[model samples]
Target: MPDVACPESPVTPPPPDTHTRSLSRTLPISVLLFTVVPLVIAGLLTLTEGAQRLREEQELRARQTASLLAGRVTQLLASAQRLGQAMAVSPAVLAALQPPASADRAMDEPPSRPEVLGDPWLALIRSFPEVDRVELLDAQGRKVYTHPPRMQESPPVRHLTASQPPWYPREDLGSIEIGLRVTHDGADGWVVVGVSAQSLARALEPPAQDGGELWALLRDAQGRVLMLVRRIAGQPPEVQPLPVIEALAAPDARSRPVVARSALDDSAWSVEVQASLDAYRSLVLAELLRFGLTVLVISALSAGLAWHFARSLTRAIREVARAARAILRGHYLNAHVALQRDDELGLLAQSFNHMSRQLEQRERERDVFGRLVSPEVRDQLVQGELMLGGQEVEVTVLFSDIRGFTRLCEGLKPRDVVLTLNEYFTRMTHAVQRFGGYVNNYMGDAMVVVFGAPTPDPHRVERALHAAVAMRRELAAFNQERASYGAAPLEIGIGLASGTALAGQIGSPERCIYTVIGDTVNIAARLEGLAKHESGMQVFMNQATRDLLPPHLREALQPLGELALKGRGTRVPVWGLPEGAELPEPPAHLRRPEEEIL
Candidate 1:
């Protein structure tokens, strides 16, 4: 087949934006659209969904409350029946039933064996405070016993029958009375107890703080609302049933009520809990108000943050450009950008600063060393073969962090805090140097020191321990001075670990740091954290570090047990030295002090 030349596809250009906007102006508007607009839309949707959810929750709550009330009512009835059954079988009631000696002998004469019934009735009333009255009637419907001896004639024995409903309204006495028919040893009568309607009404009413009304109805087997009880928020219970309960139960357009039914034995009785629709609406409104306010505050913050970010970004860029121009004009020392941020832009600013510093250092070297060394010698010194990677070397790492430094600084001015840290670090550095240790890094209120790094040391572990003890001694002296000035004393926790780690200058070509890294460094840091929380001990070390100690020194160390440190899978055994524990004096040649360091 002959090869045919094919035409290349034309590249399509994007549509031009005639009007370009500055980031400082575009950011706030874009943020408002992306953040505020979405938030507003979400708020509206949330309000709608929240209202529906709240309505459903209220209905569910009403159903649960109604069910609870029904359970309570059932319990009340069951208890009353049990009490009645027990009273009917009592000897006192049976004695009262026995032919009341000489029934016709004297109408007003004190009834024989009155004390028998009287004692039992009084005891029954005393045992159950809710029992308003304890009444015993005979088979002939004759009232035989009453808790409180009645002076006048007792009300006609109306509710003393087995055929009557178990529970009935005592209109004459203004109470709801429930009775149990008793037939024991051929003795038949009714054991009746009266319960104050108001008490029962109060039990059915919801708590006032709930901001809802409760309406409890007691209906007959025929579904007639026999007893209606109503309670509004912050109001006493209403035991009197209105002529029509439907009027009281009528709900508004927004009303949603939950109805629950419970039957007492065979008695068809139900309890209904109707939470106020208005209360549900109020709750939903309150929640929406909080949501709206939160959204408003967040939107405001987003806009402010966007504006600030745009302004800072542009300002930093401008500063860098200006500095670049200055550097081009041979003003390397003066060309620098100062920015305070932890983000990418901050890194850019830092890079610029590093570049300026390197340039200025090179310029100074040329000016000062130019006359002394040859051009070739100067070049070799300036651009030597740098160790760009790390090497595995056994070193003893010491990590120390100031305890309560944050709290201490809270009470001191920023300048005073800086001065205090400088003084503290100065003493600590002297202590480490006295034991032939190099202070590696200062991270916030923490310090990392290394022994046997960049220089071989056979006794690195011993030196690290000596340095830790010296640091403790220095801190005590420092604290005494602070106490004399009525200032708060500071405390520090030290952790030492000895192991093989990657040690060398590590970083980008622009900026490098000679530091150690590996599991040993991590263990030291973790131990440092643990020491701060440990009681009686200010210094801690891993088992590996402790293993290197001599028997005499090891005997003084307290076991810290196996600990599950973070970022490590296995539990590491640790040892600690009490604050009062001291090591033997160092060799005469190793007795260099702060004065010698100075």
Candidate 2:
């Protein structure tokens, strides 16, 4: 009947292909969230705070300017008042009141009219630059003396009036007069002090290049613009009339009626202090522009930083992702991430590299373990080995020793001895491995090799014997090469036995070795010792090993009579090929001892 084929098992599908792609996608997003977002938010907050500070600064500047202008106006008004009072108290007017001392005083009385008496007073008033024109009036409503009287004809004055009695109807003086009471011999009479409207207007004028305007207006008790300063001709028509009167009319006015005032004025003779809103606004606007520029610069810098941080974060994430992929692919040596910042991203990269190194170390350990154990045993040991364990098994053991190694070492320098020994061990180890034997351990120039414990071979005995012959042949060539360098020829003795041995790993768990321990191992070592001492040739085999060989192989072996061995009370028979027996020679450099003899 035709064989019925079993159905093949279903192959498991691989994991989703998007795993790495998903990680890459999330990296950029995470960088944006962690790096860029906070930077933008902080930049915006800083801009807002800067703008607020700028606004406050502008407001404070405006208030200070307004206050300074108000103070200037108050000073101007106080100066004007002091000049008026000094004019009112003139010594010239007082002298006019006293009678002439001589007879000529009668004739000079005509020259002594109030006009002559007021000359000095008028001159003094004109001497002051801020004063426009000064005039003195008698109580009869007629001008008695004047300085630049023609100035009174200008349009600024509504009307000029004479001084009158305090109780007289004030309207009769046309309400334009400055009524100051004169006291002579304790009797009071009204004296008029008239300032030219133009002169007063000029006094209120700021310097032509002052870039600001100042004005003063005189008003009656009823609040009229009796005199208006006309520094700039076209004053606002609406402002031509006195606003102080209207302000004073309001009962809620809090400023003292006769004190200096700002734009908030409420007195008949109020002074209005004004500074240009345009100039102030220009300053504020300039500051605002500056503030705006500052904010823009800061925002630009912040954006640049944000971009830099974002890119840095992105790069770090990419590096980490790349490293992780490489590690997953079993590439350990070059797995690393870009270290960009001293922040979390840098720390993450450091951790990823460290983890990769640890994984690499573990993988290296696994490879070393594979080399140490047989494949079957390695699998079980990797699963986890027990320290307190061993197994008894039938196996073939081979022992090799360099004959007269001590004498050779004594004759050579320490370095030369080590070099020769290493070379010999290297050749012997290669031969033993080729024959499927494990080199259990080395004792100076001696080696213990075993077969069929970690990995069992049915023809282990034959393999060990074959390896011993190969080793002899290889060592001969090694020595022939050394002889050219003035070095002695190398001779190695091999001993083989087959028996049950206790085998597994031996020594402390931390530093254990896999080897065999039994009578078979002891016999093999004893045979190798015999080869070094009483040998007819370089290799020896015990009777047990002899029994294991085929008849044709046995013919190749030459028997030596029974010899007493240490640790054993009985004699053991040993055998070897004769020194002159035909055996394949390696190259001239690798000739055996027998080949060298020929």
Candidate 3:
């Protein structure tokens, strides 16, 4: 049978709307969210907590640095005090501090022990570079001698005590000077030392560690910034102000500057330590950036993998859908899906392919089975409705035979005879099936057709008569085609009868066929032989079939009084169609091409 394309099957639902999101797009999104969202949230939380802890640590460090610097300053002052006491009691300074031996001796004259005092004072200055200068004062608290001899003398120390040192500001040098009284061996004098503010600031600065910056400043009792030290990462120590450093920072950069303060004991001075938060800030930012990059990479990989799998899955599904549609359109042979995979989808594909192969095999068997019997019987058998045993049915049987088929075969080769029969049978079968009849048997060039056996039809007799007329017309066209081929034309006679007959599978289990066996079938074959002998008739029918035809078709039948013999107990009445009778137009498929007629 020709394949009929069915756009949509009644049993198959329509596909989803195109606007709906496909698995390919939705899968990646789902996977990205499933994988990346938590990572990003966790990263943000880690960064936040780490930054907080880092700031706290830096602040604590700053406080510790401030306390350390305060203690260091106290130590430095104590050490200086000890050095001054040592120098004050030394013989050279005591001698230098003594009054001039006589009034006559010029007061402007240098002390006799000036070299001794100068040498020790210079050595002290060399040992403690923080000390800029040293001076000697007399018991009257007057400045008398100085190392690296000053051009003019300054006011001497007042209220100097042996137990407590006195500190005085040196405005000219941006420093402070302290006086230590000497009482050893009744030497009443003071040894004064000058301390550089810059040196003090450098001494108080903390060491660099972990990429942080520490800024230290020495403030006096008046709150003046006497000295400032800046220790920044990737740079040398500087003395720039806090405002300048802040201005140089990026606008979006964030840092928590922690300040710690400590007082210098007995000096009315304080040290402030400020720690830069940018060190840990930069580290946190770098970590955040790395985390962000990791998240992006993971999300991208997840999306890519999801897309790949979704594409493979959807592609396989589409292939299966296409194959299923092919099956619905009756193209069983073409219904197949090709997918190479090891996953569940592969298994599905295998199952679908196996199903399609089974369908194709069944279709092939159906076609081969259809060739042996009529398509109607094949359908009945496929539907499991036709029984193995015979059943009585009111069947209208039409029997047709070629008048000179035996003579025609004698004149042709065996191959030619077979081809001729095939062509002739092909047209006849089409005519018979067109009117709801199926060829039950083919006896050489003769065909026995039945209607209303497997399927009941009230118009079975009318349909059988219509089929007889259609066959007569098809034979005329067949003769025309033979004439075109320069072959001899052929003739045929048809006989139809309607009666209760045995109809069903009528053979052994090894090889079975569906056919009818009754007087009606015998009578139809006898009428076909009788038709050829009639002077002007092409078709004959018994009384039972003629009576069943409608009025219009009944009026067209010519009366043929029956004279029957073989297997009949009584004479039977028959009706015939005269040679000159009107042959109705052939079945609608007559207009089809010769190839299609097959």
Model 1, residue 479: distance off in Å is: 0.5
How close is every model to the real structure, measured as TM-score? 0.36, 0.42, 0.48
Query: What lDDT tens digits, residue by residue, belong to model 1 across residues 114-144?
Result: 4655555577567765556667766656566
Cand. 2 Cα-lDDT = 0.57
Worst 10 residues of 1 by lDDT: 1-10
Pitting candidate 1 against candidate 3, the one with the higher TM-score is 3
Tell me model 3's lDDT, rounded to 2 decimals: 0.72
* CA error at residue 551 for candidate 2, angstroms: 4.7
Each prediction's RMSD to truth = 25.1, 34.1, 33.4
* lDDT string, candidate 3, 1-598, tens digits: 2211111112333333333434434444555575677788898998989888877888788888888887876676666666776787778777666666676652454442346555545776679877766777766566666665663545434455565526555654336677876656656677888776666666776777668677776666776665567787777777664455344322222442677888888667777887777656667878988999999988887877765666566667678778889999988777877889886667667777777777677767767776766555666677767756888999999988888888867778999988998899889999877777867888888888998877788778877877787788899999999999888888888888899999877666555667788989988998888856686887888888888877777778898776764677888898888876775554453233434322
Runs off by more than 4 Å, candidate 2: 1-331, 339-352, 363-381, 508-511, 533-538, 550-552, 579-598
lDDT of 2 by residue, 497-541 (tens): 898999876666455655689999989888878765765675677
Per-residue error (Å), model 1, residue 373: 25
Error of 3 at 492 (Å): 1.2
lDDT of each: 0.70, 0.57, 0.72
Candidate 3 stretches greater than 4 Å from native: 1-340, 583-598
Q: Determine the C-alpha RMSD for candidate 3 after optimal superposition of all C-alphas.
A: 33.4
Query: Is 1 or 2 the stronger prediction by TM-score?
Result: 2
Is 2 or 3 the stronger prediction by TM-score?
3
